[model samples]
Target: ACDVFSIRAQTASPPAAATAAPAQTANAPGAPQHFGRSAGNGPAAATGLWDYFWRGLTENYFNFAGRARRKEYWGFCLFWTIALVVVVGAGLFIDDTMGDPDGSELPVVTVGLCGIFLLATALPWIGLNVRRLHDIGLTGWLFLVVFLPTIGWLIILVFALIPTQARENQWGPVPTGVGI
Candidate 1:
C-alpha cells in the first residue's frame, strides 16, 4: 500500500527540471548579458542618402569618425545651413536675371543642381546617427523620437551625448576603443 501511494505521489509531481530551466538560464554563468558594444569607436554606416537624412531629422544623433563631439554637429549644421542659403539665393538670383522668360534653362538647371547638392551633402550623417544609437544600445528607430520638438529633441540630444552605456543594451555588440 505504501509503495502504491509513493508511486502515485511521484506520478502526480511535476518534473522539477522543467521549472528549473528558466531560472537556471537567468542565473547561468557566461550567458549572453547585453547586446551592443561600448561607446569607444564612432559611427557605423547603414546605407543610402534618404536613410541618413531621415535618421538625423528624427534622432538628433550625429557622430562621425567613430567619435563626434557636440561641436562637430553644431558646426556641420551651421555650415550646411549657410551653404543651402547661398545655393538657394543664387538660384533665385538666376531666376531674377532670367526675368520670368519662358524656355530659359539656366535657372532651372541651377535650382536642380543646388537641390541635388544639398541632399547629397546632407546625407551620410544618417548612418553616423544610426551607429551612435547603437553605441547607446538603442534601436536606430529611436531617431524618430526627436520629431516631438523641444521635449523630444532634448531627450534625444541627452541620450546621444550621454556616454555610451558601458554594457550593451540592445542595438548590437558594444563598440570598442572609442570614448565619448
Candidate 2:
C-alpha cells in the first residue's frame, strides 16, 4: 500500500505557476516600505463611530501603551454615556415594576445592575482615559487631575477636549487619522 501511494504521488505534478518562484519587487531608492497609513488615516477613518467606540472598549480594554485619538476617546464617552443612561432607565423601570414595598427603599435589582455595570467598565474607563491623555502628549498620571475637587474635574474636562499631538512623542506612533 505504501509503495502504491508513493508511486501515485510521484506521478502527480504541480502546476507550473505553483512550482515557480514568486517575483520579488526591489524597493526604489528612498521608497517607503511597510510604513503604515499616512497622516489623517487611522482606524477612525475606516471604521464607523460605533466600531471605533467598541474597538476602544474591547481591543484596548487593558492596553496602556498606544496613543488614543480624539475620536476613540470621545467615541467611548458617547457610548458609555448612552449605556449609563440606558442602565439608569432600566433601574428606574425595575424599581417601579418589581421593588418590594416592605423591603429597603432602594430596589435591589436596580442597584445590583448599576453596580455591576460600573464595576465591569471601571478598568476600560481608566485605560481609555490614560490612553487619551497619552494622545495629548501628557502622562497617564495626569488622570489624577480628576481627584482635585471642582477645579480638578474642570481640568479633566479640558484635557479630554485637547487635540491629539500631531507628531509622535514618548508614547507609540501618532494614531492614524488623528490631528491631521
- The CA lDDT of each predicted structure is 0.56, 0.76
State the lDDT of candidate 2 residue by residue for 27-132, as single tens digits. 6566444322233323434555687678766776787766777787778888888988899889989888876788778777778888998998888888888888
* Tens-digit per-residue lDDT, 1-180, candidate 1: 469878987889668997677544433688555423232234754433343344455443433323322333444455557667888888778777767667555678467869786677654555555556666666667767767867987877776676666654445444443452
Off by over 4 Å in 1: 1-65, 103-110, 131-137, 144-180
Clashes of each: 15, 4
Which candidate leads in TM-score? 2
- Name the runs in model 2 displaced over 4 angstroms: 1-46
User: Best lDDT goes to which candidate?
Assistant: 2
Q: Let me know the TM-score candidate 2 reaches against the reference structure.
A: 0.72
